[model samples]
Target: MATDPDNPPAEVLAALAAMGFKNTYSGGYTHKDRGKVLDLHFQKDGTDLFQGWKAEEMEANMAAITALFSGIGITITPRVMTLAEAYA
Candidate 1:
């Protein structure tokens, strides 16, 4: 695991991209706040996810990511940013 949040593990980034999560604010940045690891926003627009990703796909994708994270012993959890918190 990379110590830099802007550049997390390659596999983590890949999985996030594959899951339609946009790197709105890397380095765990979010709406004037900073946490750890990364801040991946799923929907740039209100309730609008990436094309072809769809709402239903999130479950499976998340499952895969969870598995991958578990394999790597990553216990970092993510949160959903409000529309006002996300990028405009």
Candidate 2:
């Protein structure tokens, strides 16, 4: 069977939920920082899995996510986006 990279495995999602991350639509999830929303998207590159998000918010939640998933061996990749790209 084929699996979608954007949508992580059930175990991963469950693990993340257990760690207090809120599951958003589809493969998206978010962690709140102060009044800001740290958006996350699970993506796949070949057989490797990684999380993608806007660079502006990377510092806000990258460490937390890395720590949370380090034991599980997941990679987090930041996506650079311009203001127009981000807002679009």
Candidate 3:
């Protein structure tokens, strides 16, 4: 499997777009005395993921990404953030 060990979340999201995945949302979660945790949400169809040519299999592939990242020392947390504070 091809892997990008040094890829950042924004890059991953861009890659998803390049691969035809649609962007659904972008937001962050607040942390006390720290900063907000950010994420970019994407969604796509999931019928030809293994083939990797169609864009209609993104959701399934994204789920697989979540699982893969989870196993590879990454954590997924769903939370809310204020855009005003985030930009500042």
**Which ten residues in a row are the worst by lDDT in model 2?**
40-49
lDDT (C-alpha, whole model) for all candidates = 0.58, 0.51, 0.56
Query: For model 3, what is the error of residue 47's alpha carbon versus the real structure, in angstroms, after optimal superposition?
Result: 6.8
| Best candidate according to TM-score | 1
Instruction: Please report how far candidate 2 places residue 62 from its true position, in Å.
Output: 2.3
Q: Which stretches of candidate 1 lie over 4 Å from their true place?
A: 1-52
TM-score of 2: 0.40
- Per-residue C-alpha lDDT of model 2 across residues 1-88, encoded as one tens digit per residue: 1234444367757666665566454432232433323334443222223544345445545676677667667566657689999799
Model 3, runs deviating above 4 Å: 1-8, 46-88
Worst-scoring 10-residue span by lDDT in model 1: 39-48
Pick the lDDT winner.
Answer: 1
| Model 2 residue-pair collision total | 0
Q: What is the lDDT of candidate 2?
A: 0.51
lDDT score for candidate 3 against the true structure: 0.56
